[model samples]
Every structure is written in C-alpha cells, then in structure tokens.
Target: MGLRLACRPLKPIDARRAREYAKHAMPSVHLTRHLYTFFPHLEGQHLIVEASTAGEVVAALEKLAPGIGFYICDERGRLRTHVNIFVGKQMIRDRKGLTDAVAADDEVHILQALSGG
Candidate 1:
C-alpha cells in the first residue's frame, strides 16, 4: 500500500503541520548498529519504507531524521563512499542518483562501512 503526499510547488516548507504529518506517516528505517549510535531514536526501528525509488526512500528518511541523508549521501545526493544502501538483499545499482526501484514491501537496509586495521 502506498500513499503519495500532495507535493507542493518549489516553495520551502515552513509549516510545522506538514512536517509533523510526514513524520507520523514515515516508515521506520533500520540501519546498522553503527548508525544507531548516531541516531539513537532510530534504534530497533523496522526496516520498511514507503517509496517507489531508492532516492525517495532516502528523502523520506531525511524528513524523519535530519542530517541522516547527508550521512548516507553526499552533498550532491550521491551515496557516500563508506555508505551502502540495499533495496533488499541486492545492492542498489544507481549509487549516484539512487534511482534504483523499490517496492512498498521491500526492506531497505542502510549501512555504513567500517574500516580499521
């Protein structure tokens, strides 16, 4: 099941209600434990997101947790070098634009790669 919010024009959303609505309706995002340390509020959240594309999923998550999108994606909105997002068991193909398709029931996993000696 999917519901599309009526998108407004290019106007910035300064309205609090609109933001709250998005938050209330947002699907819980499941990330790696490493990420949970950064956003403790997201710990143990479900792994579902409602969106057609991987990009939209990221956008929805950005609405829920501020700065999360940037942590997963670069300023240009491309997947970061150390971040990995999978639509399911398969990794996304379009890392640059995150245009990979995602169904409503699909589980999106976002993980940050750990590097150490």
Candidate 2:
C-alpha cells in the first residue's frame, strides 16, 4: 500500500513545494540506519506526517532537511505556536517531537507552522 501525504493551508510556501520536499525527504542513513529501513517505502504526496507517536519522523526530517521548520496543528484545528503536525488521528503536542507510529498505508499530514497575530 502507498501513503497519501498532504501539507496545505501553509503560510509562505506553496503546496507543491511542500509535497515535493516531503516526497523526497530522506534521513541520513549514516546517522540513523533504522530510518532507511522504513522511509524508503514512503513516496508520493497527500500523506500527512504528524509528530504524535513516531520519534523516527523527526529524526528523519532533521537529516533530510535542516534549517527548515515544520508545522503542527492544535486541538482546535488551528495552527499553534511552535507546533504543527498530526498522526493518523491525533494532534502532535510536542513542537519538537515525533512520537506517532506511521503505518505504510497511512497518510502523513505536515501542517504549516503558523505564526503572527
């Protein structure tokens, strides 16, 4: 099965770019070999990656793309401060953490980290 990822309602960048990076985003196997075992199977857009259960997500992200910030949606469906992510059916509380377990056929939502008043 393939995972459908999606990252929308963003702030600065467009959805295409978001999907592009996510689609090809791969962590450095040198640092975390375990990630290569699972990430290689992940491809395409429409998949959402929320930091709710899997710690590997964060680790992989840091390795794939650094100096860039991801988003984490809050309970109210609104982007929170310093947080923007979601798992299968849960919102990520850890702004800098990924504890959600992502299945091979699950959708990974990478919400745009919203800011401003």
Candidate 3:
C-alpha cells in the first residue's frame, strides 16, 4: 500500500517577507543526473535558489527548469516518494510540508532513490 501525507495548506509568504527572502543569500541546489538529463537546460548551470524553506527552493528549481517541480512533488505539494532531499548533511525532517529550513550557503542535494536488490 502507498502512503499519503495530509495536512493543512502552507501559509502564503507575505509581500514583505517575499522581498526579504529575495534579499536573503541563496542556497545552492544540486540535483541528480537523471533530473538534468530530462531538463537539459538546467545542466551546466548554477542553481542557487533564494528562499528559507525547501518548498520555496523547489519552486525556484521549477522556475529554472520547468516541470521539475511536478516531478519532485505531488499535486498536494508533498515530496514524491522516489525523491530525497538533503540540506547539508542531514536528510530533511519535514517531508510533508517541506518546511525544513534551509540557510544560505547550504548545499541542497536532490537524489532519486535507487531500488531493486
């Protein structure tokens, strides 16, 4: 059986906070080769997303590489089962909302899970 995460919607980032986030130092995002293969334009490019939350980071990645957000997240905005995101060295704790905080200079690595024994 498949698992689902249900919760209240995320709060909207206010205009002022959005502006502040714009000014905040951006974090570096590194996706696995598979993603780059599908979104060729994002290959050989710097992906620095300006945001404080992982969800926002995904949004920025989507802007850089269209349709990527859909690939990483489901319709309700929860991260897909096959995707794993790491902020620095630790795997993210808030998978449902992706509310995990990401600071500037943090390395965000998006890795697709490998299966089959």
Best by lDDT: 3
- Across 16-80, the per-residue lDDT of candidate 3 in tens digits comes to 99888767768999989999889998888888888788999999988887899999999999999
Candidate 3 runs further than 4 Å off: 1-24
Which model, 2 or 3, shows the larger lDDT? 3
lDDT of 3: 0.90
- The runs of at least 3 residues in candidate 1 whose Cα sits more than 4 Å from the true structure, single-residue gaps closed, are 1-28
Q: List the residue pairs that clash in candidate 3.
A: none
Ranking by TM-score: 3, 1, 2
Model 2, position 2, has a per-residue lDDT of 100
Each candidate: what lDDT? 0.80, 0.45, 0.90
lDDT for 100 in candidate 2 is 49
Number of clashes in model 2? Answer: 27
TM-score for each predicted model, relative to the true structure:
0.72, 0.36, 0.76
User: Candidate 2 lDDT, tens digit per residue, 26-50?
Assistant: 3221212233334454333222333
In Å, residue 1's CA in model 3 sits off its true spot by 68
